[model samples]
Target: MIWADFSDFVSHSRQHFEEGLIRAGYEEVDGGWSGQVEHIAGRTEIIISLPPRFPFVPPKATPANVADVPWSWHRERNGALCLVADDDHDGLWWREAPAFLEHIAAWFESCHGDWKDDRPDLDLDRYFHAANDDRLYIYGDLEAYRGEFVRFGTAPNNAMVMKGRGTRPAKVSKHLRDQFGYVADLGTVDVPPRNWKDLLAHIDASGYLERKIRERLIGLLVLIYQRGDHEGTTFLKVTPTSNGGIDVRRLRSGADTPAARSARSGKDSVELGTRGIAVIGVGAVGSFVADMLIRAGVGRLTLIDDDVVMPGNLIRHLVGPEAVGRPKAEAVKDQLGRQYRLRDDQVEAMSQNALTSDVVFQVIQNHDLVINATADFAVTAFLHAAAQAAGKHVLSAALQNHGDTIRIDVLPPLAGARPLPASASPENHQEPTYYEAGCGSPISPTPPHTVIETAAVTVRHAIGLLLDEPVHPSGEIRQLKHTRNQ
Candidate 1:
């Protein structure tokens, strides 16, 4: 039952070649179907070995073994072609092997044609989805703990600062400079681009350094990109030539600082390296809170809101009036998402009300933490219930007394605690003067400074929640006691 279709394709191909219908034939070899398809350019052999799962799991085809085919450039080292660029393709896109068999035949024809033309792909490394890298070995796993010194201060000779631990020095010897050969940054890459050329072009485009200083191009260019964990910064290596081409290779960050030179980032390293968090609301209070959370390094964040940026929101929100009328969630993610140094797909925007979203719980489940800065009681209540039901933690915050006070509540898993009220009823919000734009409810007159105050308190509580510290009480109430003399 498993091999019926693939067996049929092979059996038919054998009979077809026997009767001269096509230039391909199949024979059993080493327990798999082996065949050669003769194209106009040349003939190439293919071996179709189906995993026991067959149609459910697509079989792989490998060409007859060849030597030293440059696994860096060719995905297949011993002439095996990964049948699909992606192995786990959707069943809808790839249901069976009949079409795949046809694909392999065509791929062989194209490869043979390209081979004879002498114009082969220069950037073939990008084609391989799963990397088969074992060429370069890091001695001592040296990169795992290497002290990181970022270039800082424009004071000539631009000094580097060691982002050291609490007891560590703010400055250290240029360890990376002294140890690595000609290390040049290709700038920040959150993830590998689909094309390997995006990384290679940085080295190829000329002028990373002065020709005099860079006469000896680094034997290996250290490319910094985002990885999948805390302290997520990682690297790769590539060798560039005079012709502006580079051979790309995996150079995982396996080096670490020796005990004598440990300039490790602090425990508060935001611990935000790659934590998945969700923020509900992106209004004035929500916007400011989101901005600080990102700055403090909460990794992946899902921003949810259904409101557009009102001209009034600009006065207290992080975004300017120029962004008026855009979805507040998108605006917040766009403006402040970059500075937080999130992952490639880390900051996501959902322009929907959390109370009404069906998959709201699923979204909450995806994150390590969920924050409700929406200040909507219904929404806050809904998230708290959802968070508790899902065995997750949620922080809900709101402004009160027309921004004179802000309240923060943290609900531990299954706490069943209702966060404080967002505001008084529509009629009694207690605004001395209300701004009216025609017919809707009157808008409260709140200052940007007040919003900033709320944001500061919210961040402190949120940092504690994310870092598992008891810096702020679970239901902390912060009041602005000092006032200007009227």
Candidate 2:
């Protein structure tokens, strides 16, 4: 139901919206409004339509002759201009119709002027329809195959490709061939093809469109092309059209190589990607801390947890109900892998108990740092010993006082540094009022907010340790008190 204030705002703004459009030289059409904007080349026609959820959702403006639009970077395949980035929320463009129209006019002028003032963005994929169901995995160094063919394999939902030395297909194992088809690269193009016609023309001009190759291109074709400073891959699905022509659709693709993923991870990724971290728990705080580190571009992570996800843990845990029975470490690893397109080497899951695992000491030695989030004194002591032996740093976070307090302790790698004493339980710490059905232990009443906030703080210290930044005054105890109005 619409709120009274919202209804009133809409009711009052409807007349002003229409008047603003008229003032901007727009005439009421069948469904919306139509207007013309003068550009350097000539006049360009534009159509504006108010969405059903007006004011909240911005009005959409599409070019009359979308195909004739010079630039394809900032417009959708259907000709709707992308005036704002997905993260842009500063301006409430929908509230003022005239300002919105002016924004569109500015966009057209920028496009007509070759978008000189706009930042360079390799957005050629916006020109074609996206194939949501299918995904292409790009592996190896694509730049090495600048003007050569590579080997690729295709399956129903997934496709894999790797760079080749030259035009010859590299020696691929039969097992890989069975999993991913090992075929010669379809072709290579210097520039991204805007449409199937342009793709075909490029192939023909390069003399790569032989009769045999043309037949092979009827189903699936992989093209390596230059996208700005780097080379990128595009997977095209070809189907015979009713008019005896071929339709090429671009499939969704992701980089499966470390370099590609690192490039997308931002500037600090290079440094973070080389550092390895080991998280000794996959509980609520541990799970989010690991996830945040991965998102911050940490290249390698080892998740150690023997606990399985339970329904009762959903309130504060990262995994969902689907992972209720799965090992927390494995579940978190799977989720992070899929979300970040991480390879197996990038994330390792150890489902063994960290306290008794034979490899715990080795894990501590292998990683640059170790994190203890188990909130159990025994586990903390075990990790502290292992970290001390390996001369590695350890950061530990826990909620105390029935979830009303947050405590974080940082142990440096220095020889004489010692772990801080655990805080004493508050006098008012009462027994849990609720318990899971099967478990005898009472559930800790920590809210989700406290869990996440603790995790954020933990990750900040963890990153500082990884980067060799000083995070002195190492021990912190914060009480989260509720404020009430007098």
- Best candidate according to lDDT: 2
Model 1 / residue 211 / CA error / Å = 13
- 152-172 per-residue lDDT for model 2 (tens digits): 555455665554432322464
- After the best TM-score superposition of candidate 2, give how far the Cα of residue 138 lies from its true spot, in angstroms: 7.3
- lDDT: worst 10-residue window of model 1: 147-156
TM-score of each: 0.44, 0.66
Displacement of the residue 135 alpha carbon in candidate 1, Å: 41
- What are the runs in model 1 whose C-alpha is more than 4 Å off? 1-266, 337-343, 412-430
Give the winner by TM-score. Answer: 2
At residue 84, candidate 2 shows an lDDT of 68
